[model samples]
Target: MNLFINKCSKLHETQFNLETIHSLYLTREKIYGLNKYIENNIG
Candidate 1:
């Protein structure tokens, strides 16, 4: 039972990491897009 719980916790941690990474990727993309828009407007 303890081993099963440990495995479950590990799986949950991996899922959390994926979510964090995904959000960071999305934020970076948004920043890059905004920068491009600003450059276009200024130039």
Candidate 2:
């Protein structure tokens, strides 16, 4: 039972990490798009 619980926790941690990475990637893309828009307008 303990081993099963540990495995489940590990899986949860991996899922959390993946979600965090995805969010960071999305945030980076948004920042890049915003910068491009500003540059185009300014230039």
Candidate 3:
């Protein structure tokens, strides 16, 4: 039982880390797009 619980906890931690990374990646892409749009419009 303890071993199962430990495995589940590890999985949850991994999922949380993945979600954080995914969100950061999305934010970076959004920022890059916005910068490109501004540059095109301004320049």
Score every model by TM-score. Answer: 0.95, 0.95, 0.94
How does residue 4 of candidate 3 score in lDDT?
Answer: 100
Task: List candidate 1 segments past 4 Å from native.
Answer: none
* Lowest summed lDDT window (length 10), candidate 2: 34-43
Residue-level lDDT tens digits of model 1 in 1-43? 9999999999999999999999999999999999999999985
Q: Name the 10 consecutive residues with the lowest summed lDDT in model 3.
A: 34-43
Residue 34, model 3: Cα distance from true site in angstroms? 0.5
1-43, model 2: which lDDT tens digit per residue? 9999999999999999999999999999999999999999995
Tens digits of lDDT, candidate 3, 1-43:
9999999999999999999999999999999999999999996
Which segments of model 3 are wrong by more than 4 Å? none
